[model samples]
Target: MRVLHLAPYPPARDGIGAYARVLAAALADRGHETAVVAARPHPSSPPEVLGALGDPGLPEKIARFRPDLVHVQFAVPAFGLRVPAVLRLLRELDAPVVATLHEITRDTALLRAPGRLLYRRLASRCAALIVHTRDARAAAGSAELIPHFCAPPPPSTTTSDALRARFSLGSAPVVLAFGFIHVDKGLDVLADALRHVDDAMLVVAGAVRARDPLFKPMELRDRRHEREVRAALTRHGLAHRVVFTGHVPEAEVAAWFATAAVAVLPYRKAAQSGVAHLALASRTPLVATAVGGLPDLFSASGSATEPREAGEPSRGLLAPPGDAAELAKAIRTVLDGGGHPLQGLAPGPEEVAARTEALYERVLAGAV
Candidate 1:
């Protein structure tokens, strides 16, 4: 099978880009011919670049590739949140299209009304639609549910001791919050939560980037939020307890997960999280707020109760969103070995890729 993926390519500094690279590699490993039409030019052979999303030559490029399946990794901001333009592009594509909708925002009446209209139009055009969470599936009306997949962590070369020594982190327990620094991620809440957790170092990974690439032109370089976070830390006497490792290499991400006592996802709102998947795959105990698809991802038994059967532990702990005291308590519990170590919860990348392949076949066969 020949699969053509449309999204940002690897080293593009976007989550969809990283995901496309992983999914393409996994599909290739499974004996499929995979190629990408990236948002920007990359060094990948056979010239993968297709210019930007709104480029006029995209249809010609797709016709040239002539793939059996065209898989689109969809996020609103990636297409500049231009609903009409995106809908037009989807209509123009004459392939067996399968779109994975990354986010369906419903936070406000203003965004929700048009967002729904746009999604319905896109869904009508595509052969099939995919979403990561049950909530998203329900909201999308006719979309299929697929869990967000993650590659397994690489083997740790350096120990926690070495990591601590390298970063000059002493004996304090480490709490990590990774990925791009955005207001929706609730970094402010995280800073407040750290105030209640005693003797723990908070590591805020990744650098700030434009929240909306199209509208927010200078938002990438804006550090006002960072300064506010720093002020909060100083006011709470946590300035010395937090470390900001801005924009570390991708290879070193696993090491950060390995060194942490607990990985925290303090998102105020989300559809699903690839970071949460990574922490679970790494077998690191997680502490996330009960939001979006997080509860579904963490709970083995799919209930608020503990994991069914004796000796089988739960994946991680969940607290109420934006509740600093509760988050503090959960963090302490995980660091104290009271939280369950995630085990055998998520499917491997190859298995996920196989499922995706099956979806493609079904779409092509008119079974969807």
Candidate 2:
């Protein structure tokens, strides 16, 4: 099977792009010929990345690949925030399309159409639609819940000790806020929560998502957001307690996760979180907001009232979204080993890839 994907490829610093790259690789490893078309694909992107999504010759490139199916990694921000343009592209494409709607906003501007929902029209054009969680599927109105990929930790060059020394983390317990910084990701909430905790260094593991040609997720998202986050910490007298590592290289991601006392996903809103998946892969205990798809990330939130079953290895704690006090309390619980880890409640990479491939087959045969 020749599967052509449309997404943001490597070196773009977008999570969806990384997800697409992982899925594409998994399929290719299974003997399927897979290629990606990113929006202005990074110059360093692998050969499997066919070309830029908006190139005049993209359609010709698709012809050359002769794909059996088109899998579009759909996130409005990844497509220059143009919903109609995505629909237009899907309509123009020749092969059967299975759009994996990455970010399903039930309350976004375009989602609430005058007469009909945007997803209604979106569903009409594609052979099938894939969403990462039940919440996303419900938000889409009609879509299947295909669990996102959560692989075991990648090989690491840096160890926990090296990370501690590099960041000057001396005996201070660390709370990691990983992934790209954004307003909705609730860095301010985490800062406020840190005020209630004691002796914990908040390691912010990434910078703001920059504006790329195809993935202009945050035109206004700049270093200012980082400054604002730092300022909030300063005001809370947590200036010394926060370490902002601009961008963690792939090889060092495991180290950050391993060094953390707990990985916190303080998102105010989200369709799903790849960071949560990554944290789980690294066996980091997590304290995530009980927002879209987050509750789904854990088998059970916390075992405060009841003890975990034998061999469970249960390890996540959840708090109400935007609640600083509750967030702090959950962090305390996880830090104390009240719960043990972030083993994903989702399927593994091979399983996710196989299921995706099956879906593609179903779509191509018009049996979906």
Candidate 3:
């Protein structure tokens, strides 16, 4: 089926952007004609730039392509341009629409009250909705929960051993906290937790942008969180061990993943994480907090290497949110677990893409 993906995509560089980019690639691989319409959030651009252009000739583009469905990978606050306007246009075109909820918050996590109100107006109008995990599904209210698809980074063509060596890491045990650095990401908590692991070096990758929701707040606590992350690292003498490689390019990230012993998600608030999916696709062991849709990602059957069973604990270890000591303990478990990497927890990209295709077909059949 011809499918149009109306969601934020890179080089805009955000979680949902990355998700939409990769998902579009997978849909194309599944023999569906997929095209993406993304927003360009310039530093100086007005906040309502996307909304100003209503359909912005998007209907013509959709009609020209003749898509069977228009799938929106929603990110609530970030992908504002795509969701509400696209959903509104689909109504005019009388075409089926699918809204993928990348975030599901019962209470406000990031977006301000006004932003939340705007999001709700758009969310309630979709033909159907998709979320990444069961937790997200439960939060979706009337939307469908679809498993996210993850494809392996095209076979490692580069060697991160050189990169690792360059940092004097020289085979030091590495724990990666990948993706955008935001207040919700709990980087300070991670920095505090790592103070206990003397031999381990933390590789904090991903870029920081002003549009990042974390900095949107003017509260002293939020500002102080950013300051504390930098200050705490220095105060604790962790400046050398904690490396923030601000937003490494996509092409270069796979090598870092390959070099790491484990990847951590120290999110204070989350809906679902594409980083966790990427780590799983890379077949790396994971350590994450037990919030949002994270616990649904893995299962622990006492078999550390395999994915968790339906009712089992997660494949990865989980700790309390914002507790540095608990986060540190979870990290220790992953490191001491005799190298049992988390694998086979979820379907591969092909399987996930197939499932998505079936969902698209159902939506076209008026299942939504």
User: Among these predicted structures, which one has the highest lDDT?
Assistant: 2
Which candidate wins on TM-score? Answer: 2
Query: For model 1, how many clashes?
Result: 0
TM-score of 3: 0.84
lDDT per residue, candidate 3, 37-131, as tens digits?
56543444322123222446656765677767877766645544344455566566545777777776723444568556755665666667777
- Backbone clash pairs for candidate 1 read none
Candidates by TM-score, descending order: 2, 1, 3
Candidate 1, residues 76-162: lDDT per residue as tens digits?
665554445556666776677898888775322225776677777777888998888888887787887777785655566656777
Predictions: Cα RMSD each: 3.5, 3.2, 5.0
Stretch of 10 with least lDDT, candidate 2: 301-310
Candidate 2 per-residue lDDT, tens place, 62-123, comes to 78999888888877666664456567777888888898988876235333563146667777
Candidate 2 colliding pairs: 315-341
Compared with the true structure, model 1 gives a TM-score of 0.87
